[model samples]
Target: MEGCRNSKDYMMDVAGRVFVLGVGIDNVNLGEALKRIQEYVENGTAGLVVTANPEIVMLARKSPDFKAYLDNALMVTADGIGILIGARLLGRPIKQRVTGIDLTTALFEQAAAKKYKFYFVGAKPGVAEAAAENIRKAYPGIEIIGIQHGYFNDDSKIIDDIKIKKPDILLAALGMGKQEKWIEERVKPAGVPVSIGVGGSFDVFSGEAKRAPKWIQDAGIEWLYRLIRQPSRFWRMLQLPKFLGAIILSRLFSGK
Candidate 1:
């Protein structure tokens, strides 16, 4: 913890941030976000990184506890196209969407080269292990020191394991709210240099799930692709329109 600092302290020293419906998103592209996490790891600073989308923003709006967690995060990258659109509607344009999966993929390369130790937690029983196996095959020399699936009543064991392993980064995939809260309450205090709520990234890495093709992702309709693939997400996708409407109302009232 040589260069350790709290989230507020770290944020004050970083680049610009854009507020989307009271949720602050760091105005950074993928490279910048990666660089920041690398710096955090190198500096021995502990902080939580949040990859936020429209649904997450909406959830934060409804939950004070969740909002506080976002507010205190070291960095919040825009992970949804709706968030990028919302930022522009508010007259504060974001650079790009830095998705959880993309960022995690990018980190594997860095971790491989730099030998950054990683501890993965969350997803179903075999998901994290499967993801770790794929990661080892894909990124040779990357050090994944620990893996724990997100199915436990108590966190003491997990926290204890993380402390003992002393990983540079902790990737928690316990979904949105739970992941963020877990990182803030458990991982950060455990002294991990950097922790991020990776959502379902493990599923993607494990090949249990598939991402949209590059063309679809570039078209900014990855949400639609996901909806088509997982129709159950239809209800979650509704948040995009609700998010847009909220942004419009926020702009109208604030006149920003």
Candidate 2:
């Protein structure tokens, strides 16, 4: 996403948008979102797409700069169940919850058909490489031109390499703030047309982690399943209430 645009009028017809905490999140279906992404890729649009979750939103609250960064993204999609509930509470409904992993998977499928060049960055030692290998096996003709792990100390070298590769799209799996900031500060300047922060998706695609069952996903309790598996996340889950409280106050005051 390339910042808030006057072109939102044209986009709203396909998938309406709603702003939460000054960050605009697109309310489009997967197909419509992909169409918009393809348009960006074809036209050489320089932007990042943020699959925003409640935690990401809360992070934005602490960093006004990061909030502005997200507001400037080419597009932001509702990637967490909490975001969906917040929208409903505000009286504007997002059509669906589009998780980052799902979006990344869909993009891989499209890349196979469209022959889009892709670059993978972030994750631990050999994680990104494994993800790329799995993707190649699953999607024949996908052009993953480069792979880089997340441990590098120098971003300039990484950006320089990506500049040489000239990938059409880049997926950075460097957690949340690090990933988004990396895309905004490094990938965009390197001239990657489309970049997204795909937190932990590499782990799942690389077979290092597993997604919840369809029923669990559909029920919108994937967070619970994740908690059951990784109880260490309980501290992060504390932010959920704060997120909801902010949404409630926003509705009361702004009448959204």
Candidate 3:
């Protein structure tokens, strides 16, 4: 199916208010875009959201426990440019590549313009605060509701504080399955309207991480560059190849 732009489907959540993306297969919905922010503000639960690619989906299929996490996400935006191209190769055209970093940045820019408060949850120690500071410096007058490291036990006290502060936006960086499951489990029921699962965006926003240059991003070779930078990530990123294999294999089976 072609990406359904502006289409919304209410997802299963504590609040039953989540919306899934359709228009741009890779582009997630704004309602789901801001899920994490709303969760901390309303319920103080920070979550992980994954930018799932076909390979990751395949991986999930192999790991039923992990598959459950992926299934629980409020929304899963297709992040890889390859996913878009592969979809085309498979005869399904996805028009755009929506990244977690870009998505969160876009949402924040819009919220800042509207005088909204923001809470950045997740990221390694200090990453969230650095991202919050970077955003504040970039946009003067943006209310940074709060920031917290993504690592914490279920009993973390920041939850209570977040509920009290009530920021309009919350950006979570807990990464993939965990973040998405977090948002779906929280928010809406708590009455917070927006939460964004930002993955490693905190690292990029904080200068602790680096992204591919504009040209690389446009070329869809961002993965190659990341592989060069962090050879260690190679193992995990094998999901890309696995994704391609899944598509090819599926095609073969369908043709039979």
Candidate No. with top TM-score: 1
Tens digits of lDDT, candidate 2, 76-194? 99999998898777666788888888888898888878779999998999988998999999999899998999998887888888988899999999988988888998789888889
Query: What is the C-alpha lDDT profile of model 3 across 20-96, one tens digit per residue?
Result: 22112324354555554445435534343456655555556556666565555444566777566555555555445
Question: What TM-scores do the predictions have?
Answer: 0.93, 0.92, 0.75
Q: List model 1 lDDT by residue over 1-256, tens digit each.
A: 2111112211322459787777889999999999999899989999899999999988987899999999898889999999888888777788999999899889998887878999999999999999999999999999999999999889899899998999999999998899999899888999999999999899999999999999999999999999999999998889889888877766665534
Query: Per-model C-alpha lDDT, please?
Result: 0.87, 0.84, 0.62
Clashes of each: 0, 7, 18
- List ranges where model 2 is wrong by over 4 Å: 1-15
User: Roughly what TM-score does model 1 have, to 2 decimal places?
Assistant: 0.93
Candidate 1 displacement at residue 197 in angstroms: 0.7
**Alpha-carbon RMSD, candidate 2:** 4.5
Better of 2 and 3 by TM-score: 2
